[model samples]
Target: MHPLRLLVVTLLIVTVNLLFPGAAHASPAVQYTNPIAAQRADPHIFRHTDGYFYFTATAPEYDRIVLRRATTIQGLATAPETVIWRRHASGEMGAHIWAPEIHFINGKWYVYFAAGRADDVWRIRMYVLESSSANPLTGAWTERGRITTPWDTFSLDATTFAVNGVRYLLWAQQEPGIATNSNLYIARMGANPWTITGATTRLTVPALAWETRGYKVAEGPSVLQRNGRLFLTYSASATDANYCLGLLTAAATANPLQAGSWTKSPNPVFATNATTSQYGPGHNSFTVSEDGQSDLLVYHDRSYRDISGDPLNDPNRRTRVQKVYYRADGTPDFGIPIPDGLTPARLISYDTPGAAVRHWDFRARLETNVTPLADSQFRLVAGLSGSGTVSLESTNYPGYYLRHRNHEAWVQQRDGTTLFNADASFIRRTGLTGSGTISLESANFPGYFLRHRAGQVWVEQNDGSATFRNNASFTLE
Candidate 1:
């Protein structure tokens, strides 16, 4: 290329970036710290058309419905919350105000939540509150009264979504004849947004042994439509360490009103990951990022395992969020609950294409179908050695960092030694093979680069091999 043409192209790129922010650097919404809001359980976040994310959840006090708004998902962590509605002194909606989901439907905002009577606190029922104001924080919330189900039994966790231009309501309720505590049901909400006007279909029951731990239950339904299918997820079992998420999938072209159309996964998709120290991770809601490209999983989980007395009394079930990844077959691979702290990213190998840098038996390697997905996630943070470089920290194991021991790249715990620091630190360089890729050059070993050989990752100086450039470079996904 000519010198003048190269200079003109560089100037054009800079001008375009200056005129439009994020025009050159398009980073998706994948980086967000965990425990987004402390003590906010059964979290539900909705990204509305107003370019604001609306968040609501079960307050620790279990006595009021609250809402908050922010432009970015991470901004909601410190956003001021407003008490939209409180529990009644007595009678209907008197206590146990839980799992409030805010949604904008047909130009009106509606909040769906559960409450119990003051006289009998266990008399849990579903209810709705509506608002006409553009901003939900300033509107008058008119009570829409109780949503009458098939039986006047235990019911809660009501969620609503539209499928193929038709709206439907999904919730958990106890069937009159069923022995389980509650079962999931769904029906169409035709003209009225608050009423179920069509045939009610039973989606799941507590038939599996895992679903009957502390109590036989299945609740908290959330749906995501993608890849020509409607993927529905729900919480199951007791709200203890046994609490987990189960999946049910149905084709988008099939009738959602029929029980035969949906197929439920035999096992739990997302559950308690003791390794990550997240327990009873359940009752999740799905939302997209500001770019509307990445799907974010918003749920609640406790950092500890032990809960004295009833799990309901525990106040440490904090709200959290993480990006959901997809498999080659177009299905979601939820993996497990990511440990606390920095948001992690996958290191996709440029040479192997789809294979990612993952840890196996404490050693780093580039591989596909990595189990417990956190093994493939690494947080590139400010260098433990110094600020001039970066250190790759393991997501599942918080204190551990990826460092070279005898030229072998391994995910090991930080030893607080100068040698460990220098070995772990690397200078992120532009891709040696192509654009949009990165090569990590060892800070201590100078010319040596982090490369993959025979599937294993190692910090080795270039051997003048044909695959040297391709092996050392990777694309962060």
Candidate 2:
């Protein structure tokens, strides 16, 4: 009974049986929102105008150059990463670098990329990389070489646009008597950054039929400009479900600098619907969060399918996200293709409510509803299961329950800030009364409720209680 206390009680019973093995096992709620960014892949998000949101991806062991920065997008999966650039030994900065976007332009900070020769990943071309700082997390990038353009066969993704003040760039080449596998080109940019001035065009090819799936690949282009028009969405075939997403346009009045005047889109404005495990969702990039309302849709999927039987050697791809809609004639609609556990469309905070303040946001689904894998932390979704204390917005914090069966999910943040817990689970008790009343919904109208009757309020339910709307006001801090 004393061999170092029996080796510390046999290593605390083998660390509680390797962290609780058969205690009827109930320790699984720790998902900020579901696999936010693990294994990176072709992700590319950028909010930066100084407010932060930088994501970048495709480093899959190309030897470094990660980046994360978050103020929100759910704090970019626990942000705080930075690996700028790496792997350079001789000349064109050494070997196979791929993807790498990051733009800010005209005032500094550019990043367009694609590398080659580590025994050639097809001699991937294109480059750019600069930084004049405004806080690219403390600036100083400098590496503006090789942009040349015009042809030179096997090119890479590259993107950029400016219009009216001129500045083009769009890429994806192989024009010399093409054999397939590369098309999307464009030109413009020249004021240094390795020149280009003009003559490139070619625009779209893979020639519809879902752009020739799995290899006649058109290549990621991405450029938008609504109202007066100029879209250009690109990326097709070869990535998986034959990879997808296509659309092209031009007609702010004509001369879309010729490619025979834009206008493609015989189909494929985004695809993949193998019931919804989401195969090759294409390389996309478009933003609008930070409360500007919505419009996300980052891209990259494949939760399960062949995985290794090919989808280009599926690493389960990862990075899938949603939210992007608009159609009546304004074009750009992205519907029907959800199903990966569906629940990512509640980002509407307007800084208004008060009276005792209670806020709610949910989309976290599962039951085969899909949308659950987007993690950052604080997850406990089960209809809201957990301990007691069920209420908030009573004048500040009295009796604000959400105790979550004891694991934790208590919130109090300010105004005497004290109830801070995280791993929650309650699944029941959401009330306002009888058959229904546990409200705090928004899309602006219908069924909204925040009724606390003193110091913090937002009520809009009707059929009872003075038809409340108290003209906006909410604060519980």
Q: Pick the candidate with the highest TM-score.
A: 1
Weakest lDDT window of 10 consecutive positions for candidate 1: 20-29
The digit string of per-residue lDDT tens for model 1 on 98-202 reads 899998998999999999999998999999999999999989999998887778988999999898889999999999988999999999996677888868889
* lDDT at 400, model 2: 32
- Model 1: per-residue Cα lDDT at residue 225: 88
Computed on alpha carbons, the lDDT of every model, listed in order, comes to: 0.89, 0.56
What is the TM-score of candidate 1?
A: 0.92
What local lDDT does model 2 show for residue 258? 81
Model 1 gets an lDDT of: 0.89
List candidate 1 segments past 4 Å from native.
3-29, 433-435, 462-467
Error of 2 at 16 (Å): 59
Candidate 2 on 1-477: residue-level lDDT in tens?
889999997886566446433211212111124346766666788787778788887766665567778877767877888888775775564776767788887677787778875555567788878888787756778787677776666888787877777777888877778778788888777776447786777877787677785578788787767768877787787776667788888876666558988988788877776644566677877765675545576767665545456454444566656665444366666653444432333211112111122233321111111122121112112322224322221111222323322221234332332222221212122332221212333222244443333322333343444224222211111
